[model samples]
Target: MNAKPTEATLADRHVLYQESVQDVEAEIDFVQETFQALRGRDAELLREDFCGTANTACEWIRRGRAHRAIGVDLDADVLQWGIDNNLARLSAEQRGRIELLQQDVLTVKTDAPDMILAMNFSYYLFLGRDELRSYFRNARLSLKDDGILFLDAFGGYEAPMELEEPRECEGFDYIWDQASFNPINNQMTCHIHFEFEDGSRMDKAFSYHWRLWSLPEIREVLYEAGFRQVDIYWEGTDEETEEGNGIYEPSEVGDADPGWICYIVAEK
Candidate 1:
């Protein structure tokens, strides 16, 4: 067996997070609900795009007994990490049922599933209309006859700008920093940094260079890609705190906000 790599110190955090199945269930529930809402049926097969560590794939398996999942990513290191971390949490049957592959999601050849989920803004890695459209088309092709595609998107009035904020987690702090945003074309750059006890700090652990695509624009692309329908699941703020309370409800009143996050579900 290969030795485990040392946990990166605060100064070096390319591995910004070590997620497991539970961490991804929250997102999977939203994806599944959105798919059912549109198709009027439950999804059975799920394909996870850019499935780093395959956390969501493992979680999908647990959502129901009939559920199956395929996790596709280009990084073999994280594939192995998933086997080491997330896959262990699965039952023997679930472990054998789910499949994890290391390949470019854009070119991967496999059977279509009921739904494809692109979570954590992973699609943001692609920075062009043509490239993104190609990916969306590929996703459509990779879906089962009645499958849908689900993606989580975030942006608002002031998306392309440098900003930093911290959140409290169970034991550590989670920080999402908007390192740069360009108003000219909605090109944006962001980073995830972590601060630990003992006054240790890690900066620029993981960076993303993404085109800040709008809801209408993405929906248009989904329609162009042949999806029969597209729906937006807007985020709801906590009544008392006026902060995003982590619960998302289906709605079309997706308006501008200082910062907002929501899901876009497309049906085929």
Candidate 2:
């Protein structure tokens, strides 16, 4: 009899990423509730920029029958993987409500959406201020008059440190490696690795060379991009555990945690 393959060899990185890195349900909940609170109305159309597997777009479609989403990314292979895996899981009607475009996020144009999402710190890939601002301007211009753009950012004292942090997942351990950092330019190289219980490892499953952008720089860029209002939604702390409570609200002040993630909301 033939020997079985190791778990790492048999596993799909995209599936692992979705299970460990993404919480589409919570993401959609935050977006839907926040948009309603800010705009005082339900948002029908959403566009996800740098949408890797379109997992979040699929979630948006499942949220409501009238909801529609457009996912934009430059990676055709990833988009195809999404169509084959994520989109396939959706119902026929839900599948019809979403579209995946293999194009650059900076220039891709679609129907004016009520909101756009640039989550997962994907915008950090733009190293220069001008390039980042240009992309933000395009995103703002692509939105409807009353549209809002939502982005997630991460930072703190540990953000620039070179280290590897691992968390136990269901069948594997997810590892985040900060491989290298340049303090002068705030550029960093990071990688995601997976370790299976069967003594198998998948190294550098996903890698990124990104600028470690600060909240102040990001907010200023949004203003320069012509967004009328830009707000940072800081995560609240749980009184019991003193950890993030999953409740984010607009705030002018935030605690200096060792590591932190917050949302940036820009209104056009």
Candidate 3:
């Protein structure tokens, strides 16, 4: 007989997702450093688009008292979970600088921000070209004149393959499953699953149906959205392991790796 899922099991999904998937600190560092390098000043306000669990928002507030963050997502449950689990842990002053909104990223309006982030390939959810262009235009409108928009993209030869890749974390196995792909439409369906030590598993803890936009396509769309400039930040590889070293630098060309991730920075 199968065991019944407990409250703890259900609750563990977000925790595991954070530990296994996100690197909030590194992401923030990239945003800050990139903004400073490009704009020649520090960024004080940040907006996180599709900010599930608002982990990046919480981390942003924790970085400095002068920093403020607004996190926008359509899911109220996840936003509340972020407040209870992540935001509540911050100091009152830190918490005061953060706002969580349960709204669509495409239409939500807030104070113009110094930086807007759509990380972890969340923006790929907009499959239609016009929809994506609309999003980019909206993001541009939501930013200050000198603000920067940061987005992450992942692709390579193996990205469209129907395959499952599993990596063992401290207490669980994190699995990335590419369930389906369409070459004609460039649409893909992916899922994240977790397996516990007891042999139990949380299948499809999170799922995404996204169109994999190529670099040229993304650049052209940003240009059409009125971004004055768009640049790609490529990650460096380790000498021995040949894995990403967590360092990114502005580059016009990227090496052909089986799978890779890079950042696209758009300036208004």
Candidate No. with top lDDT: 2
- Candidate 2, 178-250: lDDT as tens digits: 9999999999999999999999999999999999999999999999999999999999999999999999999
Per-residue C-alpha lDDT of model 3 across residues 106-186, encoded as one tens digit per residue: 899999999999999998999999999999999999999999999999999999999999999988899999999999999
Candidate 3 — worst ten consecutive residues by lDDT sum? 3-12
Q: List the residue pairs that clash in candidate 2.
A: none
Error of 3 at 255 (Å): 1.0
Name every residue pair that clashes in candidate 3.
Answer: none
Cα lDDT tens digits, model 1, 1-268, are 9754423352323234752113576787787776787679898888998998888888889889998889999989878888877898899999877998898877787787998889877887778777788888899988888888888887876676688878865445668888888888788888877766655666666778888888788888888878887888788888899888777777879656988888887878
Question: Can you give the lDDT of residue 241 in candidate 1?
Answer: 92
Candidate No. with top TM-score = 2
Per-prediction TM-score to the true structure, in the order listed: 0.88, 0.99, 0.96
Comparison by TM-score, 1 against 2, better one: 2
- Angstrom error of the Cα, residue 19, model 1: value is 5.8
Candidate 2, position 8, lDDT: 94
